[model samples]
Target: MSTNTENTNAATKRVSPTGLDLDKLTDWLAAEHPGMVAGELSATLITGGKSNLTYELTDGTNAWIVRRPPLGTIMATAHDMRREYTMADALRGTDVPVAKMYAYCGDKDVLGADFYIMERIDGVPYRYADELRALGEERTRGLSTELVGTLAKLHSVDPAQVGLGDFGRPEGFLGRQVKRWKQQLDTSKTRELPGVEELHAKLLATVPAKSAAGIVHGDFRLDNVLMGPDDLPAAVIDWEMATLGDPLLDLALMLTYQRRAKIVAGYETTDPANYDVTLAPGYLSTEEIMALYEAESGRKLEGFGFHLGLACFKLAGISEGVRYRHINRQTVGEGFEDSGSTVPLLIELGLESLKEHK
Candidate 1:
């Protein structure tokens, strides 16, 4: 299990991660999952995630991954460990590859926050252009195709068939998404952003009348999926934002991330090591990815501009939150200082997407 993002795996005996207590965790595991622990537990914090804190745990023989919400205050609907665990657990036998869920703990007394444990997959999350380039152009293209194909397969699954019919209120989902991201931006606003307010207004006014309902991976991107040894998506890892909504929004958000990776890599202030895998040679273009998705899912993407605009707006709001955290010194790892700069860029892109798509 490799996370190419800002993660550090430092081995320190008996020293648990910042948010976890070894003694308490050991006790809970013993109570919840009997006979799982072979020896004393040692934990290592994998700190790159902005929303949820991930920790790698080992008990001499067995290794597992634990996820919990970030420290401090969060929105009511944000970082629900039970929701994430349930979604992944439901999608187990489906076309959507997900990690094998072990247990979910909603009792805050266990760890001061809700958390879940799951099998640690040994797949690589390729995050950089150079990393994919190592696999050659053909393999990169195939991986990109596999990524979109997996998304289509996921969208094709009936939520009810997976016992997720009541997972979310899909009605008026698009409108709610726009308002939710706007509220998030307002809550995290640190400085004046020129085009955000206008973009928000335009998205509110241009909400699409028709949308296809399906499970939405709110943050769909290449790095979010783990690639197996054969260069296929072994498991789609991050499920913190998974819910029932307009599936096209997932597509729009994915394309937006592709653009974001390119923009981030082009920045002069960006670290030389940072690169966008989507821009790597032989990677599928935005049109090709969409075409493959439409063909596989048999769903026409009508009024796609609004979805793209909303995706950009959502990304902007998320970036603003990152910037807010970075400014407050609440974020960990590198690249956060550049988050504020991307917000305005995302807003401008959102406005352009609306104009072009319209």
Candidate 2:
């Protein structure tokens, strides 16, 4: 993303609640990229991000986005700002819509963590059913169709062409995922989860043969993308978990999110409210989405049952981690109070998904 470097010496500066140092950031920008600072910086933390902290930064005239690791302990491999920046930068002219990346700062001394800036695109993230409902069923369905099509487009990209051929080891990707998540679950285990171990075992035993490899978003869902005014995707954000892997894994994760949305919408005790946008009229069903991906990518989505089962297992582990942090009071935002309630149900669903395949 290109920045307008007008360089005004205005003295207005404000720090966000997420602890971004505006003065330091402005100074660094002024030194590294002269005239980029139109005025003093003002930042506001963007809520709804569950992993890395996202902030909207504006220098009175120009707007940009800043992403940094979350506060407190983080798994070293999980939130790599450089990796995210590389992916967005590589996909700059590609059909997959991504915000224009401006700069990446690895200097931890600046913000106590690495961060990057990108263009601030205008669009709604469509996190809830009510949001899409306001847009009417036709627009919502069209948006969802675009969403699946976007995934197909991403999977169609050759990693080597984007200079990301070495981004991840696609050989044995599924096995590594199962092992990695199992270790994550072990590390984050606060209490015994009844079905999680069994589910993990099933996933390990039924690891599908890896298909053609491509860039996987790791967590692909409607909320992860920005929907434009015309019902097309303005940009896809949140690439911290992105890597090269089986493309079907991305599709499976999308389906998993659909299931989680439906589950969250039905729970009365969920705090901060939850609603399933995919349940809205016009949105494609999970089966339809898979079919669309198949048609668009021209690939057989065989053994999808295994992929879905693995996706559920992965999500359950993530929920358990949230619950662990919530119980320990380590979580940052709202809606985590009921995170523990999601684990058992996710595990059960995971087991059922595996059973369908078996």
Candidate 3:
């Protein structure tokens, strides 16, 4: 974990030589993964990841990525690396493409916290469908369609059937969202902003019905995926927040990224266009996807209002926590500083979506 609170006055915060330092990192990589013994090894910290510390390591010819918890005190169940590896490894041979996992480490002596190494994906995928428009709108739309279509495939997967029976509760996913995110907000909180508690209370009163529970990628966005040079998605990264939930919530999160409503740190301006990139379209419209999902899974996805509302609430909690980290200067990748106003904006978007629906 890269987050070392050296400036903190706490004793445990003073854990010297936190995690696996690079020298040991090289030795560990050499022993566990094949082909790293003879080649020179280089380790570089990947910043801008808000949650886990990601490292890019190369042993001369071969390269891989290591993901672990941030240094210092961390919530046990939340940042569990074993669980992260479990999800990533589980996706193998499935429709979902993930970077291949090389090994999972639970030994604290190897590094302070648990860590895992996986194959490194090449090239950036289309975080914004517009980023692919370098080809043209029609072609971008085709690629974008594949993305949403792939998402539908993901939502259709049976967590239990796919050998992921240990994933966790799926029966009442939408029901648990608010409580879970609220706890996250409480744990990571470092500052206060207006309307947060009020907004949360309102959400408690306004939660919509659970439509259908399925495998929801807790954090689904374009940037989370990598596209090959062919302009197609090569792999999906960051499975730490994966969960079972109302799949519509995943769609709503995708929408929020489309508009990037939360303000970022360095860029003070709130530009809706930045998020206007419909990274995936033909695959995820409420009508199109619900039709596909219901037909494929034989399940009902009726509670659009509730699902959209939950999405807004989810975004608010995430943005608020991010805003807290931003003020403290703990965030690596910038943007989302104006998360103060994202709640209202998303709620408005939800309301508009509803109006358009009617």
Best by TM-score: 1
**lDDT digits (tens) for residues 170-288 of candidate 3:** 66666678787777667767656445565556556656543566777777766677767776778878887777667777776776555443323224453433543453333244455
Indicate the TM-score of model 1.
0.93
What TM-scores do the predictions have? 0.93, 0.92, 0.77
Q: Tell me the lDDT of model 3 at 273.
A: 37
Q: Which regions in candidate 2 have their CA more than 4 angstroms from the true location?
A: 1-14, 264-273
Listed per candidate, the RMSD to the true structure in angstroms reads 3.7, 4.6, 5.8
| RMSD, candidate 1, Å | 3.7
Q: For model 3, state the Cα shift of residue 356 in Å.
A: 8.7
Task: Give the higher-lDDT candidate: 2 or 3.
Answer: 2
lDDT of 1 by residue, 79-187 (tens): 8899999999999999899999998889998788999999999888787788888889999999999999999998999999999999998889999999999998999
Residue-level lDDT tens digits of model 2 in 1-358: 1112222236653324444777678778988888877876787778776667788899799999999987666666878999999998999899999999998999998888999999999988888777877788888889999999999999999999989988998889888888877877887888888977788888888886656688998888898899888888999999988899888888888888888677766765544324667878778988899788889999787777778888887887676666776777655555666675777777887887776533
Give the RMSD in angstroms, all C-alphas superposed, for model 3: 5.8
Which 10 successive residues of model 2 have the least lDDT summed?
1-10
